[model samples]
Target: MLKTAYTLLPALLGMFLLNGCDSSCCMDVPPASNNGLQAPTPVITLDGQPLQGNLTCDPTTNQTITLTAASSDPDGRVVENIWKVDGVESGSVVVCPAPGESKQICLIAVDNDNLENQTCVTLTANNTQPQEPQATPPLPVLTKGDVDGDGGGLYLQCDNTHDTDSLHLYPEDGPFLYGSNDPKDIKEITYNYTYYKADGTIESGPITTTQTEFNEANDQAPGICKKWFHTNNGVATIKVVMTALDDDRQTNTKTYIYNVADGLLVEQP
Candidate 1:
């Protein structure tokens, strides 16, 4: 029996070695595996130049920029590449910030094994001159007339009768009017008249005047010799472009069009 047992021990040891088991234990263990997966590496480029770190751009010239990425994986294939601007995924087309602004740009490369790598850079827009506020156009008031050609604009009654009308254009005074919240004093006003003749010809002329003089003339009586539109031609279309300039050289211009029909002058939209 002892000889049989010794012979069986050597056979058991051989079985353990063949099954990849340690000599201390007789249980079978699988060999360690290495799939050799690797994370992707992303290389970012801005306008065909390699992006190493932060970048500064001019708002006037570099309003828009193109971003791209080249990604690779050592042991696997890169399946996707994503670009993000200001932490939002915005693809490759990046809208540069306004003057005195900054944005974050990032690139992410993903491998087939769900492994990813990211690279980011900061982009700042250079500061520029402070922009001036836009001037507001003047507002026009139209009132119906009591007599022939009497009211603010040309008055058209229920019978389509033509009458003198009053049309007054007021400069911007407050936010409720045509101007900004902070009202600016109007320094000058100019009127450019364009008459569209029925014969398909156009006549244009610039009427230059100061605001003080215009107010003195137009603001006299409610309807006496006001700055109203009138035509001696049978029927025509007239366009009056009124430009108002503030004290800071900011200007706002508006066009008022009037159409004459059946001897009645009517303002068009």
Candidate 2:
């Protein structure tokens, strides 16, 4: 007829421009969008219990296991809740994990449309280690030339201006009292004296001397003294601390500084 209708109108206009419209003309599609953004669902708990896979805990009750971080945003509202453990950022969702140690433990979840989401858990700790407490052994160190032994010359025997001076301490290996009669070898020798008065005003006590334990005749009596009253010849210092208290109260101090010259007793270098 008009040359077969002009060859079927260019093959039916090339099938309506390559099928953009075929059985009766139709085109209208705009339905796949994600602009509403939703991604944030991370949760990990412990005291309330839901973790369900790997967790061993119990650091021998040396206590510390809190972990509760949460989050969930189907459309938006989970501003941030991130805690990690082996990857290292956890100042507070608490997880000690060190006795046998195996930590993975994560929680991320960020969305306000910034969209983040994480969740992990491994945490193992409990190989029986927790018993560390035994440290208290250090108290025995007395050496000031073993208590000032040859600078000894307290010649104020009666009274040159004031009196009292029987300061002689002797310990050349005699009286750390381990003599084995064992009440822990019984020791308690304390002598304290501190009188620095040359118008500086200071006087101290403690020297009744029962001299326990090592009695080499209690070192011939008259052990620690200082009761002076001599103003202006100006030399009155006598510190002397000597302490030795064993039987587990464990102590051993020795400090000396003597300079009382009106009749003499020097020792101070």
Candidate 3:
């Protein structure tokens, strides 16, 4: 084997010399490396504004936000951009979601060098809801005038049959009976009646009679009712508090003041 290899070596050297073999004939040099190349960083902007930390859409618009991003390879390579919303590819705009819905958006840009630069922008979907109107104090209307001219106490009575009735005032007559039931069959507010007199004192009446519905009526708006009373002929201030019947958990109160001259509320005194 050694003799054969030695004999072939001279022949091979002669052939190479005759063929004019140069340094290029024996080996191949590797191509240039790409390690020196850099992966670009994409510049991301939303609504023409540079992104800073987490981004939120303008609350007033409640609409989609326009996205515009740019990337360069420094090698002057062409760059391609990809946008996504909640991981789904989309257009240059990010759309808002239905009321109470929220989502995210992302963008990825790649250069022609096969090098990729990724930048992601987030868009939070928002649904604004209208504010509810607040409940206000009840409005009350008074039919009868001030206290009686003659010294007289107030009278209040309830009639269940009516459920709601417009209690009328006398034609400048004298005071009616206290808790009067002249016409008969009128139920009074048993346990819930409370009054504040002009004398600056408070009174609670466990009247202990049948209670009439304190529902919405013409005298007062819904969820309100009024109680009439005959008070001192000198002076009387009456206050009525009505509770809301529904889930609103509201209370309404109103006060009435009058002067008494004789036995009735004073009209001219």
Candidate 4:
């Protein structure tokens, strides 16, 4: 079970983070004034524009990433920024994995009114092996892309198959909902994604997403990529789990699994 407290206030005022509230706690925060308070928006906007997601990290040293708000209310609104991972409130500046592994992280922004919103991202540590030192060494230059239309469809891609990169799982959709637990907040759905290899070995669990790196596949896609998808040959079976919740706390989770042998591509079942 998750931890709980009377932390409705204080330096530790994010107990009600609401990343996955279960009803009794996520009540509708009063509006800034008379009646209706607008639901908080993600940094990419509720419209689904490309948010700068994905991060290509240096595999040689420890790195630090600062959380960005999907959507911050006007300049000031008595709100607090709460950093979270896998549905728990945490400290800022998460420690990333050393070279050669992929990791995912999530964060939620909450206000004094008890309202909240969230976003998740993935960080793939470089897998480059050191080469003999050269007088004039070449540095890897990463690039990025921007959102297309004024507003359009929901599009996100995760990629790690680079010049000499190895097995990795990539997130293709958003798997987070900040206020899903609160009846009053946007019910962002949570999911379960799994990957299995050709040899029958399987890697599975909640898929986290992160910004993509330059020169890599979908290096220009918005939103974070998924995690827990590290394979030696890049071949595997895939699954996506979607859940629906009923008022009394009952849940209806549906599991959809597929097979993919290339580009994390799924064959129709």
Judged by lDDT, which candidate is best?
1
lDDT of 4 by residue, 1-269 (tens): 12344443442544344243555654675432322454354452212444467666775556665445555654325366666654567765555567677666665666555666667777677887656432221111111212223432112222221111211112233322222222211112244555666676665445733322222253332333222334334536655554432222233444544444433333223
How much lDDT does each candidate structure score? 0.57, 0.53, 0.47, 0.42
Candidate 3 — what's its lDDT? 0.47
Cα distance off (Å), candidate 2, residue 56: 21
Residue 138 C-alpha lDDT in model 4: 14
Clashes of 1: 12
Candidate 2 displacement at residue 201 in angstroms: 38
Which scores better on lDDT, 2 or 3? 2
- Model 4 alpha-carbon miss at residue 36, Å: 3.4
Off by over 4 Å in 4: 1-35, 42-51, 68-71, 74-78, 86-88, 130-269
Query: In model 3, which runs have C-alpha deviations exceeding 4 angstroms?
Result: 1-40, 47-49, 57-63, 77-79, 96-102, 112-115, 124-246, 258-269
TM-score of each: 0.39, 0.25, 0.43, 0.30
TM-score comparison, 2 vs 4, better candidate:
4
Question: What global local distance difference test value does model 2 have?
Answer: 0.53
lDDT of 1 by residue, 112-217 (tens): 9888889898888888845654434433322323333553234211111111112123434321212223342344456666666777577444444433332334
What lDDT would candidate 1 get against the real structure?
0.57
* Candidate structures ordered by TM-score, highest first: 3, 1, 4, 2
Worst lDDT window (10 residues) for model 1?
156-165
Highest TM-score among the candidates is held by which one?
A: 3
lDDT of 2 by residue, 73-178 (tens): 8887899888878788775355556688777878898987687889888878788866754323223222212222344324121111110111112244354343
Location of the lowest summed lDDT over 10 successive residues in candidate 3: 157-166
The window of 10 residues in a row where model 4 has the poorest summed lDDT is: 136-145
